[model samples]
Target: MDKHFEISLQNRKLLYSVLKDTPKDVLCSIPSGFKNNIWWNIGHTVTVQQGLLYGLSGLPYTMNMEVANKFKKGTVPEEVPTDEEIEAMKGLLFSTVEKAQTDYKAGKFKEYSPYETSAKVTLNTIEEAIIFNGFHEGIHLGTVLALLKAVHHPKAV
Candidate 1:
């Protein structure tokens, strides 16, 4: 596997552990001023990966349209997914990440949208998408950390 695919697989492992430890109640809770719950973060992190990989790579997405919209960019979990639905979505999230890395290593990307990085560089290759997944995963991971801290800090103290 390439470096990018290797990094992506490692990230998926870390992300899975984080999500596994997150309580359902905490996952559904909304931190102040945020439109999404932890549920959305979990699912969105996975969706964006697939979007960057499969959607752009010319492979079929394992997630259906209904689940995609529930977790896709722009649509918050509150507006589309019930708590139960969000839990179910979590399963799909884990599966897609695993599949995406395999697809990515196979060089199946389709060049759909032009993605720009946080560094302001625009990417037109699957290599860029693989690198970008780490960036995207880190962003969501930070959000999950904050959510856990906010909801569990008082108890911890």
Candidate 2:
């Protein structure tokens, strides 16, 4: 296992912990000042990983396009997530990383189209994307923490 996958897996593990430990109501709640909820962040992270890795590699997405697109870039969290959608996101949390690791070991990523992320980082390879994904996940993790605080905050509005 390379370091990138290791880091990515660890990040996913933390997020998975959040999913399992947090109540469903809290997970589904969008803080008063937030644009999206913890649920949206979770789905967004998974969708972004699939898009950046599989989609950019000219391969099919491991997740359902209809569900995944709901969390794609430029999408909002106006509608609350269904239980089915929540379960699907939870299912992908670890499987996507595991499958990506397997695919990478099997040389499934033959080519990559360079993309400049909004953060000004340009990824030219799977390794870079995977590593950058950790950073992306970290940001969302921070957002989740903030959302947690907001949910309990008196000034959440």
Candidate 3:
């Protein structure tokens, strides 16, 4: 579990670096053939982790409903996020993982409602959800990388 948390934190840091380096316009742009942008993918990663871990455990998610609604599965970004909103999302990218680590250590997740992910993996416990989140985040990271490439070279696409 500690390794899981460590890896999650490391991935969040890498994501933060990517967001920092990416231009706001590129981050927000929904390139041709893509459903969402870099910002959406980053926020979605956080939202999914919150939903999978806290929501499944029947606990309130750390992020607000608005964020969850905007980035949750099956949703697309409706508008470009303001700088303030982007900063907030950047904060959440790392903070949520840190808080989850602390909460897990404190045994906050007492119950987990088993869920079968879209990939058909069943998460039967909080520990499983925590580990599964890494795989989920990695998938989104790949999407983010591809989005960045497309956004950086729109002419080529």
Candidate ranking under TM-score, highest first, comes to 3, 2, 1
Instruction: Give candidate 1 misplaced runs (Cα > 4 Å).
Output: 79-87, 110-113, 117-120, 153-157
Instruction: Output the worst ten-in-a-row residue range by lDDT, candidate 2.
Output: 148-157
**Which candidate number maximizes lDDT?**
3
Mind giving the per-residue lDDT tens digits that candidate 1 earns over 1-157?
Answer: 4676666666666656655666667777887867677777878887887777777766677788666766777777665445577556657656776676666556566565677755676768777777777788878877877776777733221
Q: Flag clash pairs in model 3.
A: none
TM-score of 1: 0.78
Q: Considering every candidate listed, which one attains the maximal TM-score?
A: 3
Q: lDDT for every model?
A: 0.69, 0.85, 0.90
Candidate 3's residue-wise lDDT over 25-143, tens digit each?
Answer: 88888989998988899999999999999999999999888878999999998888888988898899888999999999999999999999999999999999999999999999888
* Number of the candidate with higher lDDT, 2 or 3: 3
Candidate 2 has a TM-score of 0.91
TM-score-better candidate, 1 vs 3: 3
Q: Relative to the unseen true structure, what is the Cα RMSD of model 3?
A: 2.5
lDDT of 2: 0.85
